[model samples]
Target: DTAVSQTPKYLVTQMGNDKSIKCEQNLGHDTMYWYKQDSKKFLKIMFSYNNKELIINETVPNRFSPKSPDKAHLNLHINSLELGDSAVYFCASSQQGSETQYFGPGTRLLVL
Candidate 1:
């Protein structure tokens, strides 16, 4: 069984289009996070939710938003998608305050 899962493993859209990705975890973790991996392979945390409470990373743009309907589910919404937004998005989960995190397969987005 997968500990973390993401929908639409690949996404390709024109610039200015809006998109959303869904994520779910069965690990019973209290903390879930979204990370972006750029073309250069730089990984950065975008958002995190603990117990359904949102924690936005300072470096994340306002156009990116994270929503958690429940502890096990988290979704990402990108508005006015730009070329720079194209990257591999990873969903991760861990116990609250835990250093170890399990990641999903990842969603690759391409803004044309």
Candidate 2:
């Protein structure tokens, strides 16, 4: 089984649209997280969920929201997508904080 997977490997949308990306992990990790890598390849943590609980990073924009259906899944919903949102969104998992995190291939979103 895939350890971690994200839907729609690539996404293209117009500005001000809404989109959602789904993620799932078969690895029974205790914690899941969302990371955004901008065009510059700078990765920043967006959110972290443990046991379906929300733990957001202060730098993340309110336009981005994360929902965890279960401990093995965490989804990201972007509202009013802007050109700035055009980047790679990665879903990752780890046993716990500051540990080695396993990352999904990534979802590339392109906003026009």
Candidate 3:
């Protein structure tokens, strides 16, 4: 069984559209996170949830929202997606306070 999984591994959409990606982990971790990797390969954290409580990075835009239905699941929603939002989105999970994280294969989003 996959430790971490994401649906719709590939996403292609036009600008001004809305999209969502879902993630789940079977590792029974207490914390889950969302990260974005830009075209230049720069990776950054967008949002994180610890025990279903949200902790979003200040740099993340309001257009991006992360919802965690439970400790083992996290979903990302993007509204009015822009060209700049084109990037690879990755879901990760780890034990609370742990530095090491296990990442899902990632969802590639292309906004034209």
Cα-based RMSD of the predictions, in order?
A: 0.9, 1.2, 0.9
State the lDDT of candidate 1 residue by residue for 1-112, as single tens digits.
Answer: 9899999899999999989999999999999999999999988998989989986575888899889999999999999999999999999999986799999999999999
Candidate 2 per-residue lDDT over residues 32-107, each given as its tens digit: 9899899999988989898889865658789988999899899999999999999999999988655899999899
Deviation of model 1 at 43, angstroms: 1.0
TM-score of each: 0.96, 0.94, 0.96
Residue pairs in steric clash, candidate 3?
A: none
Worst 10 residues of 3 by lDDT: 52-61
Per-model lDDT: 0.94, 0.91, 0.93
Residue 6, model 2: lDDT of 98
lDDT of 3 by residue, 1-112 (tens): 9999998899999999999999999999999999999999988988889999996564888999889899999999999999999999999999987899999999999999
